[model samples]
Each structure stands twice: as structure tokens, then as C-alpha cells.
Target: MPDRLAPLTEALLAAAQKAGAEAADAMAADGRAVSVDVRGGALEQAERAEGTEIGLRVLIGRRQACVSASDTSARTIAEMAERAVAMAREAPEDPTVGLADPAEVARIWNLSALDLADPAAEPGAAALEDDARRAEAAALAVRGISQCQAASASYSRQRIFLAASNGFAGGYTRTSRSTSAVAIAGEGLGMERDWAAESRTYQSDLPSPEEIGALAGRRAAERLGARKPKTGAWPVVYDERIASGLIGHLLAAINGASVVRGSSWLRDAMGAQVLPKGLSIFENPHRPRISSSRPFDAEGLATAPRDIVRDGVLKSWTLDLGTARKLGLRSTASATRGPSSPPSPSISNIALTQGDRSREQLLETMGTGLLVTAMIGSSVNPTTGDYSRGASGFWVENGQIAHPVNECTLAGNLRDMLMRITPANDARAHLSHVVPSLLVEGLTLAGE
Candidate 1:
């Protein structure tokens, strides 16, 4: 591969400076990906894509504008810079928008320690097709599995570079591989579907196709005879597969962008108890071999581990430079951005404290409740924390699974839900959000 991105970003920065911008930043990304899908034990689709893109953000006084293009020619770069500068000149001034101070930029990073990219050669298209076909065949082999809806295998690699006029430049490469299978059980109106997937930064770390297919088949078979549970307020146990979404709600509420806009339910939750005592949410951006792990943020700021929630108390807000300044706080180095957008607050690798008990133990302790394994549409009131969603899962009675249930509405206020959650020790360690199965007490379920 050509070392073309570094010079491209540098060129964008130089163009922006020549266009008479007060400050500027530039980003470049080169990526390639291949994907294969199989169904009915045959290749359904195969795709390969490769592209390079560059973006320029120029600041005129306190106003800024971002523009991106796939073309890297010098003429195009100059035009992009000129357009961005013109747009910035006409845009309303936002005093908080500008490049990070030179001292605040990440001065050093260790990409090797992070192990973000795999060193192995890319898998051939035929190999990907074989993986997908195997997964589909395995699912079809399972008893009670009516069909393999879809099976897929994919691999991607991307290199990103960032350069700013304030003397900051950094770049990194990342790779990912994933396999998934979706299976259907029963026939006609009784058919139910479920899926299983595994993704890793390296191909060697991905779960086997057989394992993924078997899990998908089993999950679908388990839902073969799903019915609605009796309507009432019940304790709800979110299965490990879906439990991360509950924590995701909390994360969104504490996002600096939401907080600044007064749109988050957790706007006033700093230093307050948002989770059960002894539970904490930790962010570690430098975790090795994790897809979300990063040595530095999009704005070239150094990232480090921090406790977003400590012992149930709301501790910090996810922040980028702009949102931090808007709130009169220091940047948390949580900035994330794409080629066509400016940096914004976002989280990387995070893990919630796990409870001592296993998921089975938690189920036994609950005695009678709904064990939600999947959810559909959502209606969440961001400002008030009101939450309601369509859910489907197994119902627990007398400490055992009685039957699968579906078409139920789970309703509760998120502000109150997190306070009463009991985590089960079932989190997948390699996930970006390592939240375990969670049991929240007293949620209303609208069912039969």
C-alpha cells in the first residue's frame, strides 16, 4: 500500500492555511472490506470495496466548516479548502469551536501495545464464502431449525490519519473480522427467528462458524412456541445479549452533547446515584485487541481509563473538546468523528461491574419474572427518562423457565430502573460494552 494519506492530510492542512483560515485540521482514511453471505448452502452474495477519503475543517475566527471528498488531486484539495473557508466565513460564530491547544494534543502513543490491527494476510474471497456456507449448513443441520435465514462472514481493514495546523499529527490502523448466523424455527405463522454473531479485531480471535450457527439454531428453537405472559408488574431480567442496551441508555443520558443541550435525563445526575451501590462503569480506551480501543481520540487527544460511574454515583460526562468548553469543563478525550463530520463526544471500550452471582443464580433468586432476551421498537423520553419497548423472552416461574413470551411491552423509568438493577456474571469480556445480564425490579409488562 502507498503511504499516501499522510501527505494527503498535510496537503489539506496546507490548503486550508493558504485559504486564509485562522486554524484548521484534516483527516484521511483508506479502507478495504470484503463480505460474503450464504443461504440454503449456496453463496448469496459476495462484495469487495476499497476507497480513500479526505476531510478538511477550517476555522475562520470562531466559526468552522468541514468538507470531505474522495478525490485527492491537488486542485480538488484546494477547492475543498476554499469552499470550507467560505462556508466558515458565513457561518455563525461558535466561540468554543477551534483546534486543541498544542500542549493538549497527544504527543506519543503505542499502537503495538493496543494490538488494534491483525498482522495476518487478508482472507481470500473464497475463504469467506466457505465460512459463510459452513455456518449456514451447520444451522440447517440442527433439529427443529426450519431454515438458515442468513449466514455471513466479513473482514475489513482501515487506516486513519489526522493532522492539525496546531502541530498535531497521528495515525493508526485497525482490522476486524466477524461471522454471524440467523436461523428460523417452525413453519408459517409459528416461525420465530434468532441470530448469533461474534466479532474480533483479529480473524484468529473470532468464534468458530459451528459455534455461531449452533447458538443461533438453539436460540431460534427455544422461541418455537412463544406466547404472551400474564399482564402485570414483574421483575425483568435482561439477558446478557441485550443487557448492554440498558447500560447504553445510561450512557446516552450522560453524553456531554445531550447534557449540554439539556436533552439528557441525567442532566442533573452528576455526583448522584444512578446505579445500585457497588456498581461502577469504567471506560478503558487502551484495552488490547478490542475493536473500540484507541490510543488517541479523533482530535489527537490522548485517551486514558476513567470511571464514568463510581460505586453507583454519576462521575463524569463523555466529552469532546467542543462540548467540554460549552460546559466550562476540560475535555475528557472522548472525541469521535467521521470523514465528513467534526469531532463529537463518544465513548470507547467500557465495562460495568459484574455481580457475584451467575445468570442462573439470578434467575433462581427472582423466582417469578420476565427474562427478556430480545427487544424491538423503543419509545424513550430522553429528558424525563421514561422508557418503553417491545420485548420477547422466556418467563420464569418458581425459579425455572416456564415458556417463551412475546409481544409484550416493558415499561419503566430509566432513572429508577438503574438504581435497582442486579447484575449477573455473564458479560462477554471482549465486547465494547461489557455489561452483564441485569435484573431490574418492578417493571410493568403489558401482555395477555
Candidate 2:
């Protein structure tokens, strides 16, 4: 654990005792970040962020109370602890929740796996800004391209420590880096803009700057003269990126927290055939290149590979220690936390199984359909598996791409979408979801 953590944990416990409380815990984290963005081949943004936050929780009898602070002063941490203890004494009692049992809190394992201090993740501010500048300049140089909306480079490093009265103590540190490029193209009467973004836990995994710039330029140029297609039901093709976003939707429904609340659409769908016969989705905390990969979850439990969906049937639920206690089921080491807070249910890496076909082959089979490359917003009701969102992409016709389209809406229920899915032979392990281009047989498209 970070040296800054122990004192506060002791302080919270002492304060809780003074308030006649039974238990207490404290978590604190500090970090720094640098980010830069460019537009029209000019510096649009260059900034750095450094911050620290500490929080304390106290349990009085059956009641619990918590408080947090951005200030790291000795007086502030102690004050936060006192306040939490005081609040716990005044709050209503809840018999169901408290700190993890002493026996159940897993030992904190090696922390080296979480380190991301390499050249890629720790690239200096100048290097990061240069990446953004190079990418943006290339975008503006694209043939027929007018300008760039934005090009950005960013890197961040953070560390956290969590300690509780029940002999639970642990912490880890990691870094993140990302880059993106965007551009506008077309004649005066018909113009369009598009963007490409890439991110990784390690800086070395970032695509070459030239590659990023060229892809952005080509994508924007391709969208020139984009027009809306006829409104009707049509097959939908999910790009590698779009398919990854869909997997995020899957995590929410399969997590134990949502199901316990009776809010997950998968609450009653266990053991049922949810996907195609050969499809499977596994949560792998050990995936080598992902930022989210970890040896254990937020609650300090070992995280191993977990199959949430196997051979088309529902498999297991991602869980935290608290939820596992309530549900009487073993956890899959899916605990996650935001900032330096309590554990929450979350997956590590989402590795979707792929078929043995190329993306090109999948498009050939599509004949005529919409290829969704980017999603603007998330509008999924996890409880009901209902979804509708704004989308932009190109139209596929006669076994080839025909024209670009924009300002369209793709609406469908996830349940039905899964059933109608006609899997493509192409699946790649990129993006957070690690899915392939997906083609669905039926859907409703709304456009002008």
C-alpha cells in the first residue's frame, strides 16, 4: 500500500471507536495527466491535470457513513474521518451492508502487472503534443480536405490505496495514453468530416502517427457527398469499433449488481440460448495489451478468465465481494472501482470469439446494408434490453460500398438483435469489446 494510506486508515478506525462505531476504512489516490488537442493544423488545447483525493468510511453499529476530500493535509484526512464517524452515529441502520468479512478479503498479489510507466504511457508532454500536431497537419493535407475538427494526444498516471479494518489492504498504479485524428472533406456544396481514435494502456501500442493521419484523411474524404438512404428495414453491419461498443452493453446485463436489482434484462435468461450456437464471450483479466487487465478486482480478489456467455448460452455473472455474499455465489474476480472508492462489479477484458472469415467476405454477403462505423451516444435500457442510438456510416450495395450517410438513427432491442445476428467470419481483438464486424438481418433505419 502507498505510505500515505496507513495513517488515514488508522485515523478512521480511531474516530469510529470514539463514536462507538464497530468498523471503518479509508482509501486515497493521487495522479497526474497531460493532454493536447489540435484543430486545422493549429494548437487548440494543451493542458495538464494533477489531483489527489482521499475518502473515509465509518460504521457505527449497523449504520455507515462516508466522506471524501481533495485536500491531502493531515488535518483534512483526520477531519474527514471524524465527520464520517459522526455521520454514521446519526444515520439509519442497515443490517445488510458493511465491510468485507476478514476471511473473504483476498490477499493483495503482485502489483508489477499493473505498471504502465513505459515510454508509451509516460511519453513526455512535448512528445504527446507533437503526435497531435503531426496527425492534424496530415489530415488538413488530405486531398479535397478542408480542415480538421480535432486531433488529440493524451497520457495519464495514477495510483490508489484501499485499506479497511478487516485486515484488507491493497493498492495499484497504472498509466493510459491515447491519440486521435479528424478531418473534413468535399466540395463547397457537399462536405463531410470524420474521425479516428486509438487508445492503449501502453504508449507503444498506439498506431503510428502517419497511419493515424492517413486513415482520418481517407475516412473524411470517403464521406464527401454523403446522403441519406431510403428509409426502410435493412441489414446492419457493425464495424470492428461498433461491435466493441455492443459488448459494453453485454457487460451491464450480465453483471450481478444489475441482476440483483431486478433491473438486468438477463435477470431470468440464465442457461438460455442467448447467442448463436458457436458464439462465446469471455472476460479475461489477463489479456496482454488491455489497460483494464488486472490480476484481481477492486475488492482485492484474484481475477481469472470468466465466461459470461458460452456456446450461445448464458454462463456467469460478474460480481464483487459484497454482491457475492448476498447472492450466495462465488465471485469471478470482477470487482472494479471508480477513483478510490469501494468495490463495484466490472469485467477486465472482453474477448469475443471470432468466426473464420474476413471483414471483406462479410461485406460481400451483406449485398446491400448499412455499415455503422461510429456511435454518437448510448441509449440502452439494460433492464429491458431496449436500445436506440444515433449513428453514421456508409451504405453497402452490390457487394461494395456505395455512398456515405449521416444523421441517421438505428433502433432495435438487443434481444432481437442477438437473435437476428448473422455472424461474420471476421473478429479481431482490438478496442475494448474485442468484437468483429457484425451483420444483423433485420432492423429499422430512420433518416431524412
Candidate 3:
């Protein structure tokens, strides 16, 4: 709970100051999780984990060092602070390594309106086991499903407190509940597998286990008897379930860290068109009850809505305090970090502009191509924007799904591919990344 975590962070900051650090930040996280997994109508594994972790980042002049430990005792906290200060003394100096300015820290936030933590009682182990068992049973009930490989239910709650020498101090609590199932449709060498999962901040908002399992079963059944498609340059439709990854690549490309290192393909693309005209990408960190919503970033900076891409033009790079300073730009308040790690720029929630057409309409527009429901591996060149990935899904012919496909590689230049994509309006509104199914033209497919 924040009540307990706050004192630990206060103790850490006090210890850091006593250890001769010029400035410092402390984070204390307390969390517990319970998970149950079922297979073959029986309980296969059950786990419960609970722990508290504390981290310290100390700055001596322009140098900094980070240390973390599971131990939260006074002696351990003091030792961590001393160790961090000593490490900072020997580390290379970086001008951007100090804490946020006191005036820049978030001072006013509304936690209740965000609705981050669910007030419901934690689910018991028996309840989780029952959910997993029911999901497995539902998957096995489907006619074509040869097996329910795994079904699981889980719940977790975490509270975090952050304090810094710059007078920034705040904490928040979060909870998550989830159910999932993986199904296999055929036997031995002919098997094809798929999965379905749903997670929500509130237990009541989570979908039923039977629904999750049945969806997994149907997805796997649809992949039976898959074969390679004819190799050629063809259109490709990235299904809504996985289309966010396509946009994720662009997000990575525009990350301030990558731009600073000159290693990103989009390093030279600021203010230039990245997507097709009329398309845009927006980021908002305050969406109520969403998993990624946060009132303040890791550096204690307020987070707000901003456009990363506007009308197809690259508008802003995702930035944290350090990256923003390095680029001589304002911070975007996108910092994210965990115990034992330093803060880095990370997007919260993003939505690519949706189109007016449906996914089926996009498929019809494509006429014939690969409808990628799943992808594996990656060979994306961050510097060159060349992209390739192993894919499997249905093969479409004459604007309709013809048969299942497998063991194929899709290749394209991300810069070119993004510019050519046509989005469909079926993006799940609940997700952090609300990207729609995307239709891209003339990609090289390596298959039969």
C-alpha cells in the first residue's frame, strides 16, 4: 500500500542525502500476484508471489548511479544509498543526469477520476483455479479443438511511491485481472495453435473465461490445414489484433533516444510525412481505467495528450527529461522506469487514426493477399526501415478468405509501407494502442 511504501522512499531519500549525493530519487514498490493454470481439466500450476522492492538513484555532480534491492530494512537502505553514491563517484559524468527541477514536478493530480485501482476484494486461489478450469473445459468443448494447451487466470495489485530530492513525491496503486486460453486445433504434425486473452483494471470489467476460451478455440480451428501461399508481390492486411505492432515500429523510430543516437530511420523525418495524408497518431495518458494511464511520468512530470503524428506528418518525438534536454526540446513527460532501471522515454496510450471502412471492406479492396492474424520473429532494420517477419493466417482470393496459410515471410520498407496503409474502423477501443486492421499494398511475400 502507498501508506507503507511512502516511508521507505522517504527513508531512502534521507539516506541518499546523508551519503553526500547532490541530488537523488527513490522508488519503493510493493506488489503481490496470484495465478492459476489449468490443463486437461485439472490444476497444473498455482503460484503466489508477494514482495517489496526499493530503488535509489543518486547524483554526485553530473554523474549518477542506480541501485535496487528486495530488502527494505534501515541497514539495507543505508547501504544502498552509500553504494549508489560510491558508484556515482566513479562513473562517467553526463550533464543531463540530475533530477527534475523542483518547479517542473507535478504538484496537482486527480487520482480518483483516473480510477486506476479496483476496490474489489482480491480473488481467492480457489476462484482463480475455477476460472482456469472452466476456460480449459470451454476450449476442449469446441469440435475441432484437439487440446486446450493452457488456460490461466491471474490477479495482481501493486503500489508504488516515488520521492526525489527535488521535492517531488507521489504514489499510486494499480490492479489487474486477466483470463486467457491457448488452443490447438489438430494433432501432432498437423497442429495449429492460437490464443485469446483479456485483462482489465477492474475484475468486473474482465470478460468471462468461457468467452475467452471459446474465442481461442475458434481462432485455432480456423487455422487448420494451413499451407504456404504463392510467393509474389501482393497486398497484406494486418488484422486488428496485431496491427498495433506496425504502428509500434513507427513509435520506436521516432523515439527521442533513437533520434539522439542518429540510429533511427526517422531521424531525418521530423515534420515530414510518415503516414498517408489524412492519417495521424495521438497519445493520451489520462484515459480513465486504462492500464497505461498515469497522472505523472517516472520523473514526476505531468502527462497530457499530444500528437506524435498529425495529418501524416511526423510531429513530435516521445521524450523524457534527459532526452528532451539533449535535443533542446521540451519534455513530453513520457518517462517510464522500474526498479533497478533508469527512466527512459515510453509512450503511454496511443491511437492511430481509424478509417471509415470495415475490415471486410479493406479485404475486398485488397482483392487477394495474405490476411496476417499472427506474426513471428522479426528482422527490422532500425536504421534502414527494412522490415521482415514470419507470418501465418488466412490466404485471401477474390476479396474473400480462401484457405489458411503458414510459414511465410512478409517483407517491406516500413517507410514505404506506412505511407501506403489503409486503416479499417474496427480498432478495439479498450486497448492502450488503438490501431485498426491495416491494408498495405505491394509487399514481397516469400512462400510457396
TM-scores of all candidate predictions against the true structure: 0.99, 0.91, 0.99
- Model 3 C-alpha lDDT per residue in residues 243-311, reported as the tens digit of each score: 999999999998889999999999999999999999999998999889999999999998999999999
Residue 277 C-alpha lDDT in model 3: 94
Full-model lDDT for every candidate? 0.94, 0.76, 0.94
> What's the C-alpha lDDT at position 62 in model 1?
91
Q: For each candidate, C-alpha RMSD in Å?
A: 0.8, 2.5, 0.8
Model 1: how far residue 44 lies from native, Å: 0.7
Q: Which ten residues in a row have the lowest lDDT in candidate 2?
A: 112-121
- The full ranking of all candidates by lDDT, starting with the best, is 3, 1, 2
**Cα misplacement distance, residue 401 of candidate 3 (Å):** 0.5
Q: What TM-score number comes out for model 3?
A: 0.99
| Residue 379 local lDDT, model 2 | 84
Candidate 2 root-mean-square deviation in Å: 2.5
In candidate 2 the C-alpha lDDT for residue 55 amounts to 73
Off by over 4 Å in 2: 5-19, 113-115, 119-121, 187-189, 339-342, 425-430
